[model samples]
Target: MASAAATSVMGSVIGKLAAMLTEKYKLAKDVERGIRFLQEELRSMDAVLQMLAEKDDDQIDPRAKDWRSKDGGIAEEIRELKNLVSEQSERGKRYYDINQCLTASAQPVLLDPRAPALFQEASDLVGIDAPREEIIRLLKCEEKQHKVVSIYGIGGQGKTTLAMEVYHKITEAFDCRAFVSVSQTPDMKRLLRDILSQISKSDFDQSQMLETVEQLIRTVKECLKDKRIITTTRKKAVANKCCTGIAAQMYEAKPLSDEDSQRLFFTRLFFSGDDCHPDLRKVSDDILKKCCGLPLAIISIAGLLANRSKTVEVWSNVLTSISAAVEKDSPIDKMKRILLLSYFDLPHHLKSCLLYLSVFPEDYSIDCRQLILLWVAEGLIPGQDRESMEQLGRSYLNELINRSLVQPTKVGADGTTVKQCRVHDVILEFIVSKAVEDKLCYHMEW
Candidate 1:
């Protein structure tokens, strides 16, 4: 039985190799040579193994038995060949890695949905009057001192839009001003040089590369010692770090209010909320509730619905698909991609901890102690001892909160530590989808 199984496996592998050589796949010369060598070796082994399987034990020669034995023979040769294949594979990966490194060093194209909104006309924006005023008030541009305002919030909540709006409004007050968007994996030298180019006059040559980030920062600061700046980010640490040694204000961007959400949703689909059809109003409100006032989500879904039939059946089906975490559609998939920017930025362990929140129902206030214990049991949180594990788990939780991916519902008596938290429904849906898609966790609905 063992010899027959080995013969069958070898034959199957040889067939695959034969197919590969005949297929349209473009193979490198070395790889094609290796595949031919493996094909011949495997074909020979398959024939020998088949003959050995057909023969009785007494009829088999001792040499053939030796070849089948584990000590050294055909099995040993196969093992050595496997090791050789692995080594070649590793070499190929290393070659690709070098090319990837070169690609990484080049300027990355910005594909972020929010990046273009920085240049959007203020007239095209909705629900900005209040937050815009608040941020501008925090800036206190009238003061002689250079002030920095950092706006932060959950992804898709319009932090970038608000900052850009305020920047345009008060930019004239300062002689030298620049609006730069920092990415998750920022190129510091390029970023600093960008700032310098924006604020510096024509004397600033964009062609000359700066030697170092620190030198660029000194040059930028020297150029803008009296300039006011507005910054926006999702991570609180980033906000705080950028505001260091400067008079700074941290403004958390708020979701559009219900009225504004309706306005935005309808304005994208129709002339205004008043123009919404009677049949679509209820479904629109339902969709808005699921959106949770997220401007990007609202606009995306509304834009999708605008192109399709505006019937209750179609709209309701869309909402139902969202509830079911169905990403087969384009708009929802795009929104998931956009909102998952925060999730993609997380470290591996924090990502696991964040996805585990999908186990809870949406808007469920999770107890910190219970969540930490579960995380430890699931091997999501790593540490040596129970106390240390729990401590580490809490830190992971705090990091997620700091990134604006999770929300704190209850705090400890010290008023600093988060004791309970909840994941927003919009975020939870994507987390559940991601968790299931990656096979990291099984999501079972009750």
Candidate 2:
């Protein structure tokens, strides 16, 4: 536990060092170089501590202890630390082959990739159809004049999903269209480049040739002529900036209605309340009452319950867990408590798979194939054969999607497979915190 706490502290220091290297800090080249040096050293120290923590006293070499005690000469201490680092490296290579751990029969069946799309459509959105229509009308895609609209709201209000629904509905009306999520730390060059790549006619990577932000923006402006664009952000100020000097409108996202909330809640668990067991109705209602009409909150709780047996005893236990875990706190804390229930319920392998996603930046769309390859490379996937490994990876992803832990973004050419996906900002935030606490990933806020 002490070593784990040390690892957590080291993660924080490493994150701070990373922030110092960013352009915002304006760190000098030499100072930046020095910080990088310390970064490497601290990381090595972190690994040594973790390796030692996993060992029994009798298993630890006396020389390592002497070095830790500062009883050895400088040269001796350096030599011992290097040896420990080497040992740690070797230990890391000892991957737990998941393929050997469980038989193929034990694996859960893969969820249909299309299952996640149930909530993506306007009709499936339950309460937000009016907002979707209003935003589309606001775009005025039929008009020759280009127009901009921004959907602004708190995280988890479905701002991105609402904007995306509108984009899919009206996208064909325009000659060219592109949708990109602007990260908090906006990489202007990359942002402009992504926009061009999406909407540009030519196959060539147009943004690659342009080195400066100005050139990319100029090229983007040239391509965006007479195009309808919609932007979503948490802050109204940022939304207004996205609308700067354009015919623009701002729409605030609202929570799901009581009736719609119940509909969405049941849709996740049973797809309809008629299918729900009579005994569990009261507990389900109590859970939704706690959720308070937040769509993400509803999906999360419903996902957690979907796999469990439909019984009052089981449902009541989950309700009690949520109540016991959270007080009459702020909505954010309540949401976290709900997410915590889902996270804790996951099997060990899925926990690692979910936490791996914290490496991606917020609002980033992740490719399913690429993510699967990453899981295999990280030794997170295990199977007797290569085919099974890939199959298992997809199953893991589908399970998360079905549980509403991950959001499916793009469908494949076949129209049934979820080819691309992204984590909701609220879920991403929660995952990052858990990742940092477990030392599974490192993150820093500037």
Candidate 3:
């Protein structure tokens, strides 16, 4: 148990160091190499800890102090690493990748290529037809204007699915059309080439493609003249840049109505509620309320419950577990699987920044300014050159917003700046679970 605890702590420190290495990035190559070596060693330590963990709990000797080093070199080594990191911070280096890293990197490995809910049959895609049709109408109505209409909203709101439905419905109206995914890290040159080829119905050669935003715009205009192009991305910022010279409109995906939410969840769980016991229906409704009209959450939970036997006791126990888990509970495989993609895509600095949000309760409204101040107090947002930690913190928040991990709930009157934000309950659950796993922080609920 002692060895396991030590390994866990070391692992957390190593993770923070890696995050610093990526975002802070001030140390010399040798220091950077040292951190990597330590990271590998810590991973090995975790393995040893796991072996120790596998021993019978009853057989474990709490009095055994062999886990501590006799030579005392381990403590000294840790102190040295800590001092190196501290020295780097004391030198006053600041974040420099705001302009560069904010955009998608050239090559990004999407953690999971297949999102199950996104691929569900159209008939099974409850509550999507209305918004999907309206978006298509807005796009088709302005056909002469060559407009770019985007469906934007928080993650798990079915933006991609809605956009795809619209894309398929409207494809026949245009001579050429392409549907592509813009990930957290998007290679503009490569993505554009792929889009251009898909729309042009040819094996487009890219041996000498220029790599500039201006060139990308030129290529699209020249090749896809008067032809509709559609893309599904997480943020309005990316949508605006997708076709800068063209008319771009953002259509926010509406939350599923109460009726729709329950209907979809119930249908997925059972063919009809008529066959269910009266008590089961009540518990099902409670579970659906927790889903909060987010299709991903509802579908995920329904998928989780599908294999289980339907009984009042079973449903009630499931409800109690989900309510307690506060996003981490219930078909955890569903919640964890979907949310991990977004989590893994973030830079190391942002990892802690995003997870710190779990300290707030699920569905709690966070004032943007106050959140920034708290981050400053916690020293999570470091100062950048000529930029206050406040400014850097705000940028970090916006970056999270852009990445679709943190959803902005209310905007300022100008409708441009985010005044308030909230993490999706399902995502908040993910943050809590992860923070616990990383030993970053803990939450206590009565």
Candidate 4:
């Protein structure tokens, strides 16, 4: 009995020691990983600081460079020491959290060819090109003060596209310019930051919305007193409020004219280098009329046509099919119906993300960072085992933006930057209505 008790005690002691060693091994590995990640991040930060220093050479004298170099060397040494301490103490939990926070805090970088190749290819395929002439005309009109040109039309009438085209055209003429989307569920702070950030060509902290707005307004008044500012809003009331002192001209974008519709249809259907079988126009025109000159409707129908034979009868039948699918309400309603078809076709997770976007008001432009943060906060995005919530949120937003439901309104002056998003008013209305219909959100009537 004495021998058995001694054996058991020895076994327990050995097990405890093994467990301690195993924990230490894990700590060591985590510390190593944390150190490597930290080192890489530090290197990137150093490169950025160096670039900034180079840009502000006059502010940083020759002596400052030597000081900076020494400072960087000290930082590296400190990091190494911290890594050692992390390995020895608390099983690297602190280091893991630090690494996580670092990753979460980093802003998303928008890489070029930012959207999916399929979207770019689709844009190229249909030649649903921007109208430069109309854009220039709008810009020139915006240069004249007291000119309120309302591009008024029902939803899906391409108002946002026309507005964007005008914005890009006139951007060079303005010293400072801002574009904001005021949706049904307006987040004024985010809208302000997005506009201010665009004009300043920098990342304005969303938390500093009031300060950013004040600075932005001051900059606009001083530098672009005569420059044009363009904003889109679904609510006339909201637009009226925001545009009181800022917008020089408000052009309400209308649906395409019958002639424009026919032209757009022909361009989409037959303008491809391939020859259209003469019957294409007869069928294309019928599809175009069924779309009621709404760009989205036209485009959706055209997309359907692009996949099939380009006969007039086939085109007419396509229109009949679309009409059968859509309920009669307004041109905007038809457009929504068409857009819904596309939305329904999306995978489950993407559908959830897209609907979550309805929380913003019409024409409300969303910063990519802000959108991702909101998604994370809402718990709509899934947490990754290895990646931070922010990273996962970014990936989700990028996926939605790529699908073309979200339009990129502004890209920063930095060649590589996150693009601000704006859903078309028609799209926003559809989302909001869907949200209300499903009792997912309460609509506040103004």
lDDT of each: 0.69, 0.77, 0.65, 0.57
Q: What is the lDDT of candidate 2?
A: 0.77
In candidate 4, what are the lDDT values of residues 1-446, reduced to their tens digit?
22222232333333333333443334444655664565555455445454544545466668755655565454555455445554545454566567668756856534423332212332332223445354465546524453333443456665655666566556776566676655555555566556657655544553354455566555445544454555554446655664565443444555677776765555555554235566565655555666777766765555445545656776677667667876466776677676776566567766777888877766566888888777776767655432467776766665555444666656557633446877766667777788778777877865
Q: Which stretches of candidate 2 lie over 4 Å from their true place?
A: 1-105, 112-117, 120-122, 141-146, 199-209, 218-227, 244-246, 363-370, 382-384, 409-420, 444-446
Question: Cα miss at 73, model 3 (Å)?
Answer: 36
User: Which portions of model 1 show Cα errors greater than 4 Å?
Assistant: 1-120, 202-210, 326-446
Error of 1 at 242 (Å): 2.8
lDDT of 1 by residue, 1-446 (tens): 66654664565556656655653433556878989998997887777787877878789789877666532345545555555655655566676667557635644222222222222458767899889999878877665877788887777787866877788898776676777766444677777777767777552584255577677777777776666677777778888987898888888778789999998777766656777789898888878876777776776566446546889998898787665653443443546754554466577988888888878864567998899899999989654469867877777776666444665656656555666777755678788889999898796533
Model 2: per-residue Cα lDDT at residue 175:
69
lDDT of 3 by residue, 1-446 (tens): 45544554565566666776774565556877887887788677656566666676556565423554221455445556666766655453443444345433433222111122223367666787788778877667544556667665666777766877887777667766676655344566777777777766443554145668677768776776655555655567776677577676667667789888877766655545565667677788888877767776776566446536778777777677666656554433434553564466578988989989978864567999999888877879754442466767877776676555666666656544677887766577788889999998976643
RMSD of 1: 18.0
Instruction: Tell how far residue 339 is off in model 4, in angstroms.
Output: 2.9
Candidate 3 segments whose C-alpha is farther than 4 A from its true place: 1-120, 201-203, 206-214, 231-246, 325-446
Model 3 C-alpha RMSD to native: 21.2
Could you tell me how far off, in angstroms, the CA of residue 212 lies in candidate 1 after the best superposition? Answer: 2.0
Winning candidate number (lDDT): 2
User: How close to the true structure is residue 374 of candidate 2, measured as C-alpha lDDT?
Assistant: 95
